[model samples]
Target: MSLSLCVITKNEEKNLSRCIESAKNIVDEIIIVDTGSTDRTVEIAESYGARIFYYPWNDNFSDAKNFAFCQAKGSWILTMDADEALSSVDKYKILPLLDNEDIDIYLFHTLSYMGSSPGVDTASNLNIRLMRNHKGYQYKGAIHEQICNVNQQLIDKRKVKIEDIIVYHYGYLDKAVAEKNKAGRNMKILERLLREDPEDNFHLFNMGNEYLRLREFEKALEYYRRAYRKFMPGLAHSPKLLLKLVMTLEALQMYEEELEVLERGLSCYPKFVDLEYLRACLFHKQKKYTLAIKGFKRCLTMEASPLHLRNINEVEGYRSYYALGEIHSELGDHEEAYDYYLQAIKAKPNFYMPLYRIAENLLKRGRNMDETKAALEKFFGKNLNAGAYGKLGDIFFSIGRYDSAYEYFLSAYEQMEPNPNIYYNLGMCQLYLKHYQEAYQWFEKIEGGRCCEDAVYRMALCEILSNHIENAERFIQLTPDHAYNKRSLVYKAFKNLAVGNPCGMLSDDKEESNAYVPIIFTLLNDLLKISAPEIFEKSLQLLNLIENDEVLLKLAKLYYCHGYYRLAYQEFVRSIQLFNKIDREGLRLMENIMDLSTGFTI
Candidate 1:
């Protein structure tokens, strides 16, 4: 039997060619129905020798798709979206499935990519893409369309499942969604449908899903609750509705409510690993480690089934392992944590969190940096490219191991083309090491956007630290007027100090101060380490302007931890003067130190 590939389009110039090219060799004819074409969609269709039909834009997907299906002339019909393509493995394997006369329809696994890159964070579902032509099958619904029979009812065909048949869909990706304005269009259509039938749970559930994707949690929760109240257990989307509701509640931090819904969902779908995974996550959040561990272990016992339309496959493997690792780490079972983290890495090599944890633990234990690098390199096998090296550098940078980070960044830079992020990372490492001129040169290489702005600021600060006051002022003046530039607390404090008047640099804006004070403190401390005693003394005057006792107390502890006894003592005295009873334990420690000093009394 010959097959006709049917697709409906509207200005799908970017995606139409891919869709047609993927199935052209397997199908007898390509039938394209264009609702509207403000671009080269129709031209491209003609170039592919497709039998093209024109239909007016009526804002109804089912109607447009049904029109396309009716025009198919082959014995069998295969329908697909403009943004979807048949997988190479399944392209040549379809005709055999059609040889079975008992099957009226074929359900293919549809993998919807959620990000720019393929095979990363995909949502999978089963979809009816193939059916006998002239079987009176047509699509229904205006927005999230479904298949129906001649009687305009949901189709109840003899269906065959072919797990090997796969379709890759890219319309849901963030960039694609934004370019198509899909969310706005879908919300409009769904809202119109909801107004006509306010209590329609299917539409309500879809509305919740749309809002959830848009990250409007409160609105998503509202629609999800409405759908849950209706709770049509027999419907295909009912289980998904409950899952989405729990996820919405989780996003909103309504954990108690999420647990209630999860328990209800688990009652209905006892083996749904996603629900169990979420339950474990909630338990982990609440520090109920025993329950969380049991739940996560239960998840690992089940395999992820594609029958669950929204099954996140990782929940049954790496995600659970990672969660277990986090729990073990929290409980201080470092050895157990390390084992689970390694298992997680083994499950998904590109998953970097486990690698991060392992590296952090090794560094914290004072393990040799070279040995740690060797351990991490084993995960990449023989394919440790420049990008992988950059990722390693990023992980070390995140954990404040700038020396190790610099080494990796240098390795990445040597092997790769020019990259602004690598330059910025290198600059930051040098800046932290008090190599101002080297940092300035690295920062100078960055050219555009927010990273450029930050690099410029750092360059100015580097010049200031190197005593090139004129060059520093010139660099500062070149920056745009933003909080990180002139208005920043660091800039304001430094400017005041440069002018020999550091007393009034602190602003009365507590929120602004809270956000920027630590940055200023770190900068001043770094300057002090480089033997800038004059700037260090001026920074003390700036600190005196900050009247927050908590800030002063934290600074004292930080200073004491770094072995700056005189600075720590000064901060402790100031902290005590600000709050009479705070940090008493710290005070007792100081007194003990003083008593020991008396052994050298002259």
Candidate 2:
């Protein structure tokens, strides 16, 4: 009934200690087999009181593994590599599973965090690591090795439905794989195996995986096709092979082939969430959004199961929800998209992919600024990130709350450093707040990035607004000479007019006859299309109802977004003026008119 922990290692000083530490308390005996060690690997093993044995170096993994197993004294053997560890929960379940004689082998779900987003872990969910010594099980293959004739050896693998045990492996990470030259080493051995048995689907599959690790996606797809050609009839490893082919096809932008593979796989593995997810993703990529929405909804209906193909991906919850959000956002259903994005964020608080869509949908949802501000506050209270805080700052800045925007910009700076665009935003906040020195400092932080041109131009404006003529001359030299443009002239002229400089207003008239509102109306027009396309496309009908509160409110949002501050201010003022001439009992409506005009959040 005693268990032996068996490990095979070579130059594993960094990982040996952790692997031994996780098992020392549970196993009755610990065995370490080293082919060679030029580090403290053997010493660390000896320190843990493990029985150490040495074998001559041969570039064969299964041979080394089988050699270690033959030396085990306990009735059952638990084997893991030096770079792998059993999680705390899995460690506790080992003794109970080892005590039960009903199962001949224990399979662990190996979680590998190696995808594009490495933080979101996935697994193969079917690794045979624990088995009875008397079962006479031995390893096979020279690389990416596994039990010889696994289906024949572990015929009763489905008898126990235990999914709690897990092995966290770090070796597949980009850094780890590159350092070990693992892909190259695996490629050499797998090619040798294929030469010996040209019809071996398992060897073909192994070769495909090695190329995938090296990012030779086209070659990987070719090998997957060869393997699947032989194995498709039996559907042996259909889940793993189909996932590999589809992912490679995606990398090659072959959405049609990807869909074909997924559909074929789904016919056999009907309830597979990962297949459904990839199908939905391809539909989204193809701009078939309505179909993508259907695919994503189907993903959520799938039950959570330990069944996984080559890649362990769970789509029954947040992943599916996030995809749905993306589809709705693309289709211009901003409100529905926002709701799905909120649910995705709720499902996984640390997952940041959904956060940007939430912020973006909030900005363009056609809601009043008050509602947008309220949602931003709620989101930032729960999750503080650069996007959320920056968008909130943008909303406040648009609505003329410069002081409030300044505070949120500071919060955003903490999360996203070295972002020159946010620096420009902070400078704009300071400039409008009349903190010229502070705004100058923020603008100076930009050197040569995305917003550098705009920052330099704004620096010149800050100088002109402050009446620092000498500083303005210096900024004129430093900037791209944008201050000489008619847009800049109009901005400066109207701004001075607002500050009670009648001479400044006359100066604009003398400089050019064109009106300021007409010059910058395009910026306002663009905002209308982005934020409220329905109202923008049918503006003739809406504009005729100038006396309507809803029309005035929508116009205000567009003007605010476009930096037509003075003109927008005049419209709000006119709304109030017209309201006063109409009714006396509707003071509340008058107050709302004043609020919209005066940039007051209501």
- Go through the candidates in order and give the C-alpha RMSD of each one to the true structure: 7.4, 15.1
Residue 584 in model 1: lDDT: 51
Misplaced by over 4 Å in model 2 are: 115-118, 148-162, 233-236, 306-310, 366-602
Question: What's the true lDDT of residue 453 in model 2?
Answer: 67
Candidate 2 has an lDDT of 0.71
lDDT per residue (tens digit) for residues 526-568 in model 2: 3242343432333223133112333344455456556455545
User: Among these predicted structures, which one has the highest TM-score?
Assistant: 1
Which residue pairs clash in candidate 2? Answer: 240-310
lDDT score of residue 548 within candidate 1: 49
Residue 329, candidate 1: alpha-carbon lDDT: 84
**lDDT score of residue 561 within candidate 2:** 52
User: 588, model 1: CA deviation in Å?
Assistant: 29
| Cα error, candidate 2, residue 539 (Å) | 40
Q: Which ten residues in a row have the lowest lDDT in candidate 1?
A: 593-602
Clashing pairs in 1: none
Task: Report every candidate's CA lDDT.
Answer: 0.81, 0.71
Candidate 1 lDDT by residue in tens digits, 1-602: 98999999888999998999999999999999998789999999999999999999788999898888889999899999999999987888898877887888887878898976665587777788898888888778998887777854655544545454789999988889889988888889999999999999889999989999999999999999998887867788887888889889988778789999999888888777788999999998776899999999998888774464445657889999999999998787878888999989888977888988998777666678888888877877787888888888888876667788889899999999888988998998888777899999999999965589778878877887787877876776776664454234566567567658534646566665665567667666666545567766666566555544467776776676555666666767777786753455577446644644554431
